[model samples]
Target: MSKSVRLLNGSSLCSGRLEVKSDQTWSSVCEADFDQQDAEVVCRELGCGPPSVLQGALYGEGEAPMWTKEFQCGGHESALLDCRSSDSDRNTCSSGRAAGLTCSDPVRLVGGASRCAGRLEMKLGEWTPVDGYRWTLETAAVICEHLNCGSAVSVGKRKEASRRSVWSIESDCIQSGSLLRECATPDHGDSILNLACSVPNCRWRC
Candidate 1:
């Protein structure tokens, strides 16, 4: 059997048993209010699928510490034994805490260009310019996707009259498709100039 599962408050669950395979070692985990939700969290953290089973009392109660409680989870627990504060203390079963996640995938472009630059004229994807006319590294990366690029390496902002101007001077090694000289902006915001491979492309409204 493995060591007891210690809670954040230093309490331990020693009732039933949990079969866990870690480092090639098959050990038993103490069952408490632990449920499918907690199991799901464990699986996701370990890059596994969702948990479909929640055994209680270790099938017959193992040796040493015995579980004090059994919890019923919604199968969306964030961590092992992550239940409500009330249930966290009680030896009863209830729904567990759900895990929240945020992720981003890298985008791949077609052609290979070490650097590409364009003026900031519109917002797309997760990039939003500041003050309706400014661009930043974070915003530039979002714009790169529109050009089918990997990411933005550099960003330059220029202000002219009432229009706030921005420019991405470097493509950061994103592939370009057919040297897009002209691109129509999603809205009638501002006109932008795109330069690829040291050549200037047609200007379009973004």
Candidate 2:
């Protein structure tokens, strides 16, 4: 019998079984590609840590094939198994894509006791920090704007200093209407924060 389980519709292969340790406890596969250049793609898909150690047959081979050959992919590996296969290639196996993924910790948003001096820290997620900039008041305002929090009450620097920088802001306005502009500024150095916007209820950190 096939030890693998069939994923439901809208279920992702990354949501399927991943072999951690040496036993078969059904772990979620981290996104990491077999090839060096494509490893980051795996990290982006599983929503986990960064691809530090990429192992092909680390735990062991899977029970079945999750994907086809000709695995040309962008950095996004979430859609790896869903990609169309090469018709001309017949020697390939219909097994799962050979990958290993580890996402960096997520970015955490620490609410301030006073609401004006909140902070953001890197947590466990699929995001990374870029150099050359720090979060600012206008960035906080942008986050509030996306959340429909009216206007940003404050924005301040975080105490912890690392490759990743953090900042905090406050707002009461909630997103009710369509956004006039996606970001406060398009310039690279504008320092405007980008956040996901949801109608009715704003997901500030998203």
Candidate 3:
């Protein structure tokens, strides 16, 4: 058993059927109302990464004692247990529907004046900096999208590189990928990216 919620019989540490421990018993989570929001919470709980896919019971049907509680996470929650709302009643769960998820590496921005603007950072075994090159409004577009801030209003390139910038990005990022981690490249470089985002209710996820 893991110290916290874990994916049972998963292909990797970050992918598998969602499971939870209650009353000292491990049970599968019912797929009812499960969506990207729910998966994000699960990934956060496991410290894995952002969600990639939500396959309904594709991994396999779980055994008895299904957890029917509906977990409503706001994407920023640290754990599923910390979701804003949930129910513990198993009677609401139906049979033949379990939840599964696939997650990739996670990405974040830091060192900026605000959450929406900063040097791009990524998590791949550790936190590291991402080089700022060929950046454009498109780049800001994707970033703002993640922050749920509609789209980028402006991009302010920093004159000096941020401190401890050791990684550089070298990919054809054109505001396409859902998570910034989807971008390619594996080299290190020193560059600073100062950005600004605008959207309704953007402050919530920023």
Candidate 4:
């Protein structure tokens, strides 16, 4: 069972390599099977808002017995230990590629019905796609700001079908205040990422 959790090597408490304390020692979780859903639990466990950003091995890995138990959290678990898990026994997904997390801030917007709502396309020169998962107040705030949407109390996630491939982003955004165009993002060179955002009041005028 995971007893405690914390972020390591990140510039701030809101980001870093995912590590869990169990049996009195610190260990890293497997990153291959991890995603935004799993990341939501980490931020919530740390009292941070929804996960705004994610990166694999962004902190340069870790030493460990390597946690093989895959975590299943609904993005609301008070503690990481309370979430369910089972042994996966992975080898390719090791500590050298530990996971990294960042809270949301001003994000890139591509397509949607309103200025505030649409599919996220962060790559600078061209548009790309992103994944949809549980979002928190903080994360939603960033997206709204990027789109000039009023400060909304809540945000909802929607799904879509895009023929494009997922953007291959392997780095954490440099700053919370900075949006996608400012960052160095490489294209997956395929299709849209598929995550959608919807906000209230600021309907698309154009």
Candidate 5:
């Protein structure tokens, strides 16, 4: 069974090839051994949203040892390590058969022309716009990265005519690598953050 889990080789923290630690050694999971329930547990373990995509070699075939076991997740486990596993008889797995996953971000851009361009908002208990009072490109880049947008092209502010509720994110907290949900506090502000993200491969865009 896995003791710990992490993702590797994807564009953002929430997406990548799945790797699990066992016996103090990292091992890559085979696609045939993974399922949606298993993927759900991994995303939850990492504090990410639901799995959006699951495929083989979506990132890259990892160099780590094959897990050689099939995970049986109940879809409600808090961590991947809580799941049960059974040994697989198959010894050899093919290259490009490693399980890869991408989880949706808890944040999004809305009221714009494209998914990657608009007002910044995040889902806590409910969706709310972000207060962009003192935002910078660096902080905005974090949102872009999590959303799988290429990078931050520009950051702007949208002023509402009256004060409204918004999520006030502590820039310092975000710069320190905390997730946006962890860094936000409820506040009433008029200025909402506006951002435009570059479209790289645009694989995620609809």
Candidate 6:
């Protein structure tokens, strides 16, 4: 079995069901009581990248008590515990209703004119290009969505003239619900992924 890290219940240190501490006890957070700003603070506290996915019940509900106060973060707090709170308006929180969040793993698109278009790279211990093996629109969409660049518009393989070291992205693991960063492993490949995402203010090129 996996061990708990920090204040959240999750598989990785940065992705998991939202939980908070109050009065020397930890409790799960209700989805209604959490928001994007709250999520940002949690990610920052955990030393992860920006918030990627925020969904209720992405991780199983915990047996711990539910937090009774609503968080009020302004999106710039250094830590979740430092934010202000108010009496929770929620009367009850049922099972599978706890807030679950996935913080991004410092993934980015580069070498292109726009933030949404370029070769894919991820930062584990360091920034490394991603091997495009078995990469599809579905898998590429994960990166685009994490970057808040909307959906994936296109995915194509780019073969560099010279083979280089890269991180191999496991499509099966990702399709099975693992985050892209969690599924990446160090490997070498001849080709990398080129992606174009659809941003709200950009055309198909982005």
TM-score of 5: 0.66
Instruction: Using TM-score, rank the candidates from best to worst.
Output: 5, 6, 3, 4, 2, 1
lDDT of 6 by residue, 20-122 (tens): 7667777889888889999998887776778878999988888888887788999998878778988646669777889999877678899876899899988
Residue-by-residue lDDT tens digits, candidate 2, 76-176: 54533443334653344324443433333233233544222234333223222222145444545544542344465554432223233322122222132
Better of 1 and 5 by lDDT: 5
**Model 3: how far is 4 from its true place, Å?**
3.0
**Top candidate when judged by lDDT against the true structure:** 5
Model 5 spans > 4 angstroms off: 1-3, 87-89, 109-119, 124-128, 134-190, 194-206
lDDT of 3 by residue, 1-206 (tens): 24547776565566788887767787788777577887887887666677877886777776747776677878877777677656555576655578888765466657766676666667766887666667777766766665555767776555554355445544344344423444545664545556666655743554
lDDT of each: 0.35, 0.35, 0.66, 0.59, 0.86, 0.80
State the lDDT at 10 in candidate 6: 66
lDDT winner between candidates 3 and 6: 6
Give one digit per residue, the lDDT tens place, for model 5 in 1-206: 22499889875567899999978999999999899999999987887778999999999987799988889999999888789888655597888899999987678899988898999988766788999899888888888887788789999998899999999999898888765667889999989899998868666554
Candidate 6, run of 10 with poorest lDDT: 1-10
Query: Which sections of candidate 3 miss by over 4 Å?
Result: 86-92, 107-206
Worst 10 residues of 2 by lDDT: 177-186
Question: Please, what are the lDDT tens digits per residue for candidate 4 over residues 52-77?
Answer: 66887777777755776778776677
**What TM-score does model 4 achieve against the real structure?**
0.48
TM value for model 6: 0.59
lDDT of 1 by residue, 43-112 (tens): 4433333333345442443332323434455656554445442334443332222112111121222123
TM-score to native of every candidate shown: 0.24, 0.32, 0.51, 0.48, 0.66, 0.59
| Residue pairs that clash (backbone atoms under 3 angstroms), model 4 | 105-142, 129-193, 130-193, 164-191, 165-190, 165-191
Q: After superposition, how far is residue 54 of candidate 6 from its true place, in Å?
A: 9.5
Name the lDDT value of residue 77 in candidate 3: 76
How many clashing pairs per prediction, in order? 10, 29, 0, 6, 0, 1
